[model samples]
Target: MPYNIPSGSQSNSSGVALARSQNWAFNPPSIDVISSLHILQAQPAAVTLSVSIRDMLASSLATTHSDFNLGITLVQDADALDLFALSSSTHTISNPILLDAAVLLSMQLEVAFVDPTILLEGRYSGYIRFSITATNNSTSIVEEVDLREYSLNLERTGSTTNLLTPRTVNMAYIQGGVSPVLDFDIIPAAASSGSLGYVLSHQGDTVVTLAGTSTSNPPFTLITGDGAVSGTLALDTTIWDSKSLGIHDTVINAIFPDWNVILGMDVNVAVFNAPGAIVAPDVLEFSTLVPDNPQEKFIDIFSTNGFTITAPPWILLSQSSGVDSARIGVMPIDVSNFIQGTYQGMVVITASGNIYEVEVIYQVNDQLETTIDLMDVNFTKDNLYLQVNGYDFNHFLQVESTIKTYDIAGTEFVTTDVVRVPFFNSSARYDVGEFIHESMRWIKDPQAAALGVLDPLSAPARGLYQKLGFVDFNLKVIDRRNQTVRFIRNLNGTKWAPGRSPFNDSNGYHFQNFNDAVARITTEGFGIINIFSKEASSLVLFKNNVEIDSFVLNGGDLPSSRLLIYGGNYLPGDIIKAQINYGTPAIPQLLEKFFVVYPKTDYSCHFLFRTSYNTLEILQCTGKILGFVEYSRQSNTVLKNGVDIINHIQTNRVDPLKVNTGFIPEDQRYMLDVFKRSLAVWLVVPQYTQPIPVSIESTELSHSDNDRFLHAYDCEFKINRDIDEQIYLF
Candidate 1:
């Protein structure tokens, strides 16, 4: 049966039944007819809907369609188109297209197509246009795009090496712009023999050097199947000079002989640096001869240059001098008592080069003794003391004393008192008893020991007495008239002067009394008073008598008092005896009244003005007074007649005038006139009279009867009137 199909669907109108039918015809079939029929029927429905993504390229003047130019590219040996191809839509047209149509359509196409069969063969070659254009339609345009594929092969080159090795051994590369980078294992050389190698090639013909010339070389070590062997390389030239080896040597030596022998004296040896190499010995030895006796010794040394062995000058010959150089010498050679013996000492030599030592010995024969002076001790008290010197002397000394005593009558006595003087060191007490004993021993008289002695030659003896509370009361050296030396010592410490009481009692001895009545006058009030005595005889009475006067007496009135009868007048060749009274009122009181008498040969007067009324009635006189008499008192009316008497004498040169009725000396007439005038003024004149100025002159009178008579009348007038009467008398 044969079947035929028609296009379009059959439709039926209303009310009419429509049916569609196919006819089948049977005939002898030809193969060409069937094949031609199949080809014609598949023509439109078999059209492929292939959509490719490609870069669109458009410039100001041109546009490119590159979808048709897309060709199969391989990526890492796989078909790139296959990456975008859906396996389920390989031959069917029902699947959605995955390719980007806009990017493909915008690209400029170069070769419009690639044969699919060639892609199947893994061989592709095609061109696509990439157009770059400015948005402003500018003419600057570039139209090329490079297409690249990445093929990576990871590998390690050569054998495994330590990580510390330098990276300059193996290398890697990629061809046709393939990025070639690979990570490899860093295996130790002890574990691996070689590293894997990687190769990358494009289409097999364009081969890149497997060990790329541009790639960095990886570090590696060569392994001999055991351990790694480090590659030997040339050292850097910059550091070659620093590596070197140094050698050094030091040498020391003793230049002198090792053994030196000396008989009985100091010996010296030297040490020095040797010419060539020489090592110092740990120990050095020296030799010397032993002497028959014992002695002190020393050793001296010299320097390398042999300079006379002056280092540490004069090495001690004995221990007393201390140690010095390296030489040996004997001192104070007393070897006769010593057995045959060797005396030795060591000398140490030290320097920066080395240290060494040597021994020295010597012998000697002699005698020695030590001596000290005895007079070198300094005694504290030199006169009566003795001191011992040196370490081997006794300190004690023998002592003796001689004493003397004398009575007031000058009788002397003696006594011998022996005593021992004790020795004392610096720390002991000051021996006062020793001082007194020594002082007494030096005294001239033994009886005076209790009374004490005066030894001017012995300062220590004197000092001893002073220390024991003895005072120098009578240290006198007097040459008496009998050619005997008289020394007076008043141990009672008494002194007296005229008019001073020597005892504490009132009736005790009086040192001086100028008047015989002073004893009676001062007996009731005789304690003490300052009295003036004019002459030495007056002082005798004040010292020997006990009376003193109460009336104010003058130096001239003592002779009239008769208390100073014998010595009242001081004469030449009279020795005045005096003493200082220190008891009772004290010595200073007696000295107040005592005065040295001087002779009054000429007449002088001192007149004191008592009244403001200066009257011409009294006539001043300058002469020695001979005598005086007192007159009876009278009234003013009666004294008025006395003024007439004075007027009578002055007016008339009459002898035996009433006022001059007495036998007046001719020189005394003027004075009698003055007296009578003063008496009249005193008795008859009214009170409160105005004063009249009067001149007073003191003059020396000639030693004549006339001057003497005038002086006598003046004194008599002064004695009759009180000082207030304005009377001038001398």
Candidate 2:
């Protein structure tokens, strides 16, 4: 066996040369396009480029450079430069030529093609014209040929690929136990018909096994079936694991009949883990969707292996149950009931014995007939009570009103830009000069004279009441909507603040308003101060001054309320200070105040809810509006004790005001009552501390066509500030 040798060699005259292999049956006899030719002033000599010729039918036919003419012409625009000087030019072969299978039986010829000194800064093209004849050692001419032409392009100024060949392989990320077939293509700087080979290596101690390859040699010659070199590489990743994953880089070299071109590739052997699944849309959020509207959103579930995944019940599957292996689409059921408010839950997915919880939140917005704020005013008799001491038997009064800006979108109006009216006081006086001086004295403390019982006149009545110079006995508060509220004295003098201590005033201290307006409940004539009766039994409670009772009664029944000595001794006005325990207390445990009522003692000075038990102050003094109310779902950071745990979705709502929608006909009176019975029943059961949607309807005295008008729904109400809790049971 004879060692294989290339048929061409590099010419000493700074040029490139390629010869076709003598294994003519394995390769076709043709000319390849000379893609790139470069001439530089730095080069030593005129560049010579050449081609080869051989006898394909007679494998043992002898060949030499003298038997062929190598002609090259350099052309720029319409100008042509004769590079070969003459048509018949030849190059000398370094190795001996033998006409046999062991030898390629071919000759290579390189001409002094381009004059490096004469090369200008412009694009120049050329053509490789080959003429050859083959003969046997007996001197009998076997084949002859005229000149054939192929294009050759050259450049002197712009970036040239003459120094670099761009070769690239597809990125292979193969999982363990799987094989990936990668393909690569090389664009050579100079055109040639050749085969390619690769040198493979691993990064670490991982050993990679490659198999199922047809390439026989590292310096493999390409079999240009149709003038392109292409093949597939099979990589096995079964040996990869957590600790021994493989990353192999391969250097691919194109073995031209003469020169060699090298390129690199990076491979990654991915570790195959266990069987599990992944789901898109980790969170499913549904905006204001109409009730009874068939709305559906899809979620994609995929698994690594062909394992079956179990969907949660709320997530309505298009098919019977779960799916296996493939990516399946699932949607949630439409909200069938016509109940307005936020509904939250989760979409649970169980795959390969693993459970995944995806949070889902949705809200149903109500259609409204009007878009204005309606006043639901409640006047507490005792709240208006003004006491008359020894000064002409005239009572003192003060009123504060909060005018606010609101953002109205559809039917939802969020309060903002709260401007509180300057504190006002009203009282009757005789002498104009003395009245002004005495009025300023009462603002410090309205009960200052009474506080100093030993000498009442010695104590100055300096308080907020005297500062406003109330000329009349009656005080009034007007809101931004021009709704005027009057405050008259409680003639019976049943002050809710009964026990007034001169030494340590039990008077309430004021606190700044909350970031948002919250729900507040108020009732009148139910019961007096420190009264624990059925009417006054049901009371609203607060926790951390935030969780105020949105519902005064639950399930048509009042929450269980009892009077027990909470923090301190039961003073006359201790009920106003002590915490009011709510919910059914089976065996009333004597614990400390668990539910801290809102508007704590601040009702006396600051604006408060109407239900508050304050004599000089009307309880429902709306506070300062900070910003626009946001109707969107808010993500809350859940905390356990002091550490952060997870995120939760929360919604907000405000208390509703009653307003008449429309009136029914006289003949429809009985029919309207019957229709209310068939309507959906609303319940106020707090689920996961979230506000429950409730409907309160009543027939008004106004009638049209003998039918009474009905007022239902609280459109002004806002949901709780924090409503994020997983309601889905898996």
Candidate 3:
């Protein structure tokens, strides 16, 4: 039977039931990752719950949002409270929400359709909400109501992808101890022991949970004894031997004692007070063969008595003192600046009133002779399998970097784990774009977004294109072949926009592509033309053999990627000429005119050739072939009849229209340079002329540039008619 509304004259006999009727806020979810918000409510009767969940377990980028609001109603009838010990009832979305493999959340929310008139007939008033767990389900969700049935207006910004994950929540750290005391700000202080229930876990951030009930005598009701409903719990985990290294987490599902419905949840993590120990190498050693190459080593430190480190004047240490599980980096002050020699120092450590000494050694070894080499191949394509090929390579550590957070460039520098890519022998190749793309996933910048709208790069980072601009890939290969550690670096990876691809799903546009001039272009068939390079380089452009403009850039040595490509209004057959001059001071000197894009005409075809030479050229041919009838003015006026002399006429043959290469560059001896296996050639442009198929007449390719001119050994694309030419009219 429906209970009458309580007035000044009417009151419930049970104090526990009356207190729940008055208290508004409910406990949160069991797993720390999933949070709850009240979306619908008919005070003391029911509440519509929107469950906000955070998921961090991801191997790659994904776009999706999580589940529906749950509904819960308290036992308001005095008769029901008197007859049965019922606290609340679960309505739609009544099934337990499984958080992970183990952790499950019972009754947390509800939007009830009851006899009461004010049952929150509308949807959530504020931000749009949906029902679904972020975790892929074991079964389909039971949809009890059509969302539009309530006639509510809601707008979703794109799809909720990468919005609630890849995030690190700053949480409070508590030291793990036996019989540890815990305090909570439970709303209305959960009045009685019968009002709450819980579940427990040995781990923390993994949500660190599963389901069922825990019988640990951890009091959530008045453990402090100061107030009747004090939110204190002295977890007497005599059986849970949790005092060790790392974090100890617990998952508790707060429920209505004997009911199947859970009113709320609680999760807590107690960090380990690193057991005192001396975790350090007997000696710290650093050595390198390359000049100015950085070398690094680490020393682990964790002490309950607190610790302090003292190093020699020349030795550099990351931290002088610490009290928890941490790794302190030991590096040389100036290995590159100093000449090839051996330097030594000492690192003294004190912990738990005990002193230990570590011998530090730094050596600048003579350049070692090795076959491992980082290829000097320049590419504009993204994520096309690339590698560092050589003898004896087991693993690789690719360090991706970007601009500083506070600097004008607007980015941050980040490091990677050496062990993540373990090197047993040294052959390790990583995806340059994927690494660059992954680094930008972190929101390290503190800069705020414009207006009230959050910065796209700020928290809740969504989309593939991040706020930070570019990433410079520097790979370090640790070759441990000869029972010794040797570091080889492949710093030639100069990929741009690590967080971008050729086509973006959100923007629905073609962006990056494989255009050699668009140096940063990597995506297939989508490139930005007539754009400037991100590096500083020299380029001169001409149109129709007329000089347009010249940019002679220098001074800024590093690859700023600021170089621009402009062809002086480069149009089809515009004689777009270019002279490119760029090289680091470390590389040999060179200044050369690259090539010219020639005009297109009938009977034309292009070929693609890639080589080490600096010059490029385009070959073309035009004019008509003729056939003459027997006799005519050249011959005698023969074949003539009686009265007059007759003449013969010549027939003109029209050429077929062909689309061929516009430019090519080859070395002077490239014609006979058959010994070089590095040369590559392809029929690059205008490949789709249907009736007249295009094919290269010669396999031997050569080129002529301003520097190395070679006119012969040219590979011209000859058009083969798929079907015989039906007509060649004059």
Candidate 4:
């Protein structure tokens, strides 16, 4: 074969090369745009007197759609002939073409004038250009790619004398004699035979050749049968049960030795050990998905040849020896010898003289466990109760409130400040004062007490140490891994219930002076009683000693009540309890909410606070002329003042109200400690006659002054708001 390449080695470089074996007669020559110029150099070129175009199909690339597209697209036109009407394989053109002697004069002088190939190709179907470059003395020929390389007939993969390759299964995973029969497309159905060659070592095999193909080229000694027959040729793989494996190759040769054609096929066969004794599942994952479990699991083994089972000492097998088949129970035996940690072990079963290992493993230790146990977190009565198991966590409280600060001139500006306690473990049933976040927890500082905000000493850390406005309280609970979270939010969009524990104490809403206020059931999914209760007395209301009202609620009924303490519905020291039967118990759980009636205040002391039990404290003494006391706050951390100034600030100025405190010879001093430890405080004149706030005066009551009050201690109050004219807000 010869390739007339004008110049440059690239396929696009002017050239036309043909392979002797290529027989493509009508397909589009891939024009490779360089459709495989590689073939041109593969075999040395020899100029022959004549060579058929069919030979070019062997190495040149070509493509054809299922339609009538030949070497080149033939578009429909009035002058264009239908290409499909002509026979492709054997038909000859009706008109013969003749080239003028002048055409030869322009053609290469190097090509022999008498060449037969030039005479055979008797047509000029299209324009052609050919030239010789003087620089390299190379002939540059340009012909239509369609007519020259592709018009040759395409013989996709085989020939008449050449056998069409058989479909062989390569790298075929066969278990026993079960495999596909070789379907050879025999060229001539008779007088053909083959030799099967193999290589047990080849990971994957498809290549078939005449030489050293026996070990990689490992002989298929046990497989008996001719390579392929007329159509359905199956090899006798029955005896292939031995661990012999690899690719099997069949080289086809005519029954007569004289037929020298080297045609062949290769079927990749990965032979697996035939079924003898076997376990259905290769591996079993037992136990409770837990590393260590006491549960036992069973596996069945089957074998025509009786099987024997063996495993490590710790792996106990119910039946070690069986006839043809048996079900065996397995479990770990002596785990008691192992410490309180994970111990891993594996097991294998030897069935029918074959080592079939069903690798199973189990490791137990302190490394694993369960998921988040946060069913819900709620404030029952006073304590914030959470349903969590075996987890050590702390609560997070994010609070936003109006922080009031005054400049040296006493010009106060209110701003929002967010306070956080990530590890809040506040409790009301118990004292967790030590666990309270320091920055926001109350300390006995006179600045806070002197600023008309009394002590919250009864409980240190309430809402924000001693701060108020105290509106927003957003919080969460995070465990050690930081992977778990449980949070509660604003109950009514205005008040946070989980943050308030005041129900247990005589504390309720600040009321802002509503003659009567409605306490609606706020938390969603939580109700004092099932609104669906049909019983006569589902919700009962108590006033002091007698039952004042009862409500039988049905569906659509609002689970709420209006407490009228101010419109003479109740009296001072009156405890009105609203109880509801709730929960899953047959008798029902009694959940209670209450309201304590305090006499309409002339001057009142309101403490904005929170504990597991109390949210706020409003204390007014019954002693005549004495309301809550008040004192002036200084910016200094330590304030030095005369006992006279502390005990009695002159009324000539803004006299601290001297209300007589009917006392407790020792233990009852207006709960002064609670007055000192309040989270926030506001002294208001209920009349709104004066908007300016006042402070409880005289810091006389102390831990040591318990016995100092004889019969009573006159309480003094001061207007913390130094402004003369009354102002409303702090």
Candidate 5:
């Protein structure tokens, strides 16, 4: 009241009354600025002032204060507010008294979140004080200073001591006695002073060893912490040897204050054992042997521990018994003097202090009790026909012969042992051993297994006969009856001879003026017809210019010399007519033709057949033809045929005959080579019908004496035919 001043500040009675209030007089007017600020660790804290001078003072005083101003000061560490610098430390308060006489002054001061200098973890203190000042013209300042205290409470909700993600520690493939390293990796989330601890838990192939074992001492030096957690796990593999041959699954847990991570470990150990056993075969039995030339048999012996051999002279050991495998061969010592009886012996195989016994048993036979006979032997001036006695035998009859079948155009020659032949026993039939030359013929029907009383003409029997490469055969019967040897040879000539002809023969008939001869042939109930060559051959039949049926000739090597014309069924005086063709001189034609005929047929008819016919004529002279031409791929045609049309024909032909030939006897091979040198010394007959020259094809070692004498060998001869000339020569 220092002189009731006539001023705007004193005009409001409420302002005067507020100044008189004892509570306002005793304490500085201030508002609660902020409570304890809870914040995340490593984050800043902030406060915005809600208290104003107008709210701190009475409303009349706030409205009366025209020049009121607010002053704000942050009292704390200088670096406290560095994280968020306050935009301004002091600000002017806007007075409403100047505009409205009843309004109170209300304003705000903004303060940003500030980070503490020390990175305070718990609670940090700071203060913001606001002061009011007035120009004394109208606005009144009730309080000089207002203090708002705040505290920042930093709580560690997240941790800095973080453990890296855990992974598997694999102790890769290990051997029973080997030690390998267990490898893994780890990294700290950030720089930390804390250490990581690992605990290993596993069983079997994997184990933890201790430094020492005692009643008072621990078995292992426990690995509490390695200071470092990222490195290779170097471990001893010998630990796996304790329990080998399986998988060891283990876990390694990394321990830390904040987290625990488990790492997996798998250890696989393999088994390795030492070697030591003796192995041997069972009993060895030698069934039968021909005393003249006995064969040897072998029994095998093996051992893990090396040893030596102890055997008789008759039992030959391939090698001295040792760690490796060896063979024991058994053969009769005095085979030449062995009588026809059963023989027994023993063979001892020893290894690793172990002995094995192998028994040897055999039976020797001096001669075979079998027989063969040539029953129907017919000899014509041009060819000879022979029938083998159909009597069956218990054993095979070793056959060694050459066969030759004749026609007008070509000839065929067959040698023994060139193909697998079949043998017939009382019960069943079996193909002869690959290189064995044996013959058999079942007196009973071959198809009897299917068809009772099987016909000899049955297709099955005929097929089997042809299948064994034996349409017909001239075979030698040695050791057939009481071992009485019989010699058989196939001859291709005008008469039966002891040896084979060097060349095949052909029919002697020259065809010319066929068109003129057709008229005369018609008067003789025969008419000539022009033939055309086709891929396959067949004939059409007609009676009195009326179309009848057509028939195909059975394929495969038909003889050019003989032609058979027939219908499925016919009656006497049916007066059948037919036509056929061979080939013209076309570029791609396969074979040439000859014009000839037998008695009742027109001789001028064209006759054609492949040059590689199984039975074809190779030589011809005067009124006779010699067939029985056999071509062998092993015959060395280059040396025999001298690269002519015969070589070309044989080269183009497929060899259906597959035979396993043993090594030629050394002595016989040398003799054959010597004889081959003197070409004139050879007896090669001249071929008159085949226009192209023929030459010796082969001089092969003969198997005729295989059973009787091992060293005794004979030489067989063969020749190639000039089938290209068969076309015009006939």
Candidate 6:
């Protein structure tokens, strides 16, 4: 057994060497294994699968996943055909598996990485890599698997921290018989750090640029991590293109009608920004600049927006400077004493390049005039006379003389004589006896006598003489030198008979002659001589004692010695006595002499006599006797006794001699009585009503009647009512 078989045919030996070489190529061992085997025994060549379980498991999992796929194929280089049947078993498995059995079933598997995981941190940089493989089951065929490299970058984007997945190849695979190399850069999305940095920095229409780099072209994209990019950036400068430092919507209104000097006007100015920008230094300046030497200057400024300045201190005015607006005020000047024309001035307003001016005009007026009215006229003296009032006497005098005279006797006489007798044997001298005899002849005519007459030297005497119907004549006097006589003619003419002249005639020698003779005898004739002489003394005694019977014939009381007697003398022994008869039928009879007296014995004589004489016969008889004796007395005694007799006769006489009666007729006496009654009624009537006040007015009617009505408005008050009470008016 151990012996080698003799070498057979040389051709068979060559075939054995070819077979051994083929076996050695298929199963080549290490040198130790070959030495060990040579020392022991010879072996046959073996074929096995060389697939890693992890790789195979990965390949098997990749082949079943949808996100990634794996494919395997076996292709023999000699046949050039894929063996799908040999790879079908491994492909049918759902999970990973190892490659162990082989009957020339070469594995051809495809692997792919599916659903790859990505991770990121705060602001970090890193890389991620995944592996895939492909296997080939065939005779002498090779396969490869590839994984594409992905790079991820993490950054801050918003308030949240996130691992943003970067964009990469979504679908990639490594198949059998292909390159197993994949290269890709990973870009991690910007992560929000939950801080302010993540907020968007752009506002409005601004653009924000985030800085980043990527191996992939166009790597960076802006992401609004959070919705809170709200803050405004810089203000839109376009909106402020027409900006101005001015005012808008201005309004002006007045508070009063007229302006005054001391008080200033108030105004409000409202200013605001143009909707966006804020105003800086919001205060406004309001000032009026007047020239230093301004001539009648005045100004006024006002505003509508709120911008004001401090009021001037010296001016006495009230203002609202505390408001936020602009305003101005004007003061009135006392220009009354200035020029009388219109004055011009200016008001300059200085407010932030805004200027305004106004003109002021002042008018001057003249002073007012005043006047007074007078009510009374002045005079020189208190007492005024119609004749001698005002300037001079001659101015008001209308007559020749201021004094007036009137005749006393001849002009005032009212009697007329029938005839007159011659006086003292002269034709020019006439006796009144003829006139009296004629007057007695014509008893129906009244008798009166003229006592005396007066004459005036200047002016006419006709007015005086005509008042009494007397003729005025100038007569020449014989005895009295340088004496002019004014004679008033008697009523009757002279007449005489033969041997019996009108003068010194017995018929003319009447009781008046006897009176003259007796008065001379008693006062100064023999009666006085007897009282002083002795021879004449007996005659005086005889005459005084002798009582003549005829002397006592008349009945009544004896006459007083003061009475004139006719043709009688006083004797030294003459006695007179008065007896009173006072009783029933009282009779006054002669009794005895009351006293003894002598004529011309003394200058005094008793002329008054009182008696209780009754009986009309005795009174009449005594009056006759006394009348005869009264005419025989001297002119002086006649005058004295005549006045007493006339007074006594006037008192005692029953019938008075009728003189010239007044012109009032007896028929008109009733009318006069009625007028007097009406006057009495007016005086006694009681007034009950108020009197109407009378107003007088005088005006010049015409030139003709001007002088006639010179003294006008001469009014007098008639008492019509009792106006004594005080009246009050409301």
Which candidate has the highest TM-score of all? 3
Compared to the true structure, candidate 5 yields what TM-score?
0.21
- Model 3, 48-154: lDDT tens digits are 44333332122111122224233322332332222111123432433433433322334434433232212211111111122222322322333211010011111
**For model 4, what is the error of residue 329's alpha carbon versus the real structure, in angstroms, after optimal superposition?**
1.0
Each candidate structure's count of clashing pairs: 51, 30, 44, 50, 34, 49
What does the lDDT come to for candidate 3? 0.31
Model 5, position 38: C-alpha lDDT score:
22
Write candidate 4's Cα lDDT for 1-730 as tens digits: 1121111100111111111122222122111111111111222122111212321122232221111111312122122123112222222223221211111211111111111111111111111111111111121222222132111111111223424344333323244645444433444322334633211111212222222222223332212123332433333344344446543344433221122223344443445454455464566543321123345666666554557777788778887876545557787666655544434455566655777776655443321121111111111112222222211113333333322322111222233323322331112121111112121222113233222132222111121122222122233333324534443443212212222212222221111111113232111101121121212235677776578777653321111122222213445666666666644456665656555655554323222221212223334433445433323343222212112233434333333455544443542332444454443333432332222334554545322343573344455555554434221220
Q: Which candidate would rank higher by TM-score, 2 or 3? A: 3
Q: On lDDT, who's better, 2 or 6?
A: 2
- Model 1 / residue 20 / CA error / Å: 99
lDDT of 3 at 296: 58
lDDT of 3 at 156: 13
Model 2, C-alpha of 497: deviation from truth (Å): 33
* Full-model lDDT for every candidate: 0.23, 0.29, 0.31, 0.32, 0.32, 0.20
- Write the residue-wise lDDT of candidate 6 on 1-730 in tens digits: 1011111100100000001111001111100011011111122112222232222333332332222222223222122122111222344433432232322323322322111111111121121222232232321222222221122222211212221111111111111111111122211122235522232211221122223321112222223332222221111223222334343221111111111001111111122232111122322211111111112211222232222233232222224331222223444344324543344444333333354434343333121111101110000011110111111111111111011111211122122211111111111212222212211121111111110121211111112111111211111111112222212222121111111111121111111111112223332211111000101001111233453322211111111111112113444544432222211346532222133344542221111111111000000001111111122222323322122332232221221111111122332222222222121111110111111211111112111223342211111112222323221110
Candidate closest to the true structure, highest lDDT: 5
lDDT of each residue in 196-239, candidate 5, tens digit only: 44443333233343222111123233333434454444334455
Lowest-scoring 10 consecutive residues by lDDT in candidate 1? Answer: 12-21
Please give the lDDT score at residue 142 for candidate 5.
38
Task: Supply the global lDDT for candidate 1.
Answer: 0.23
Name the candidate, 1 or 5, with the larger TM-score value. 5
- Write down the TM-score of every candidate: 0.14, 0.17, 0.22, 0.19, 0.21, 0.11
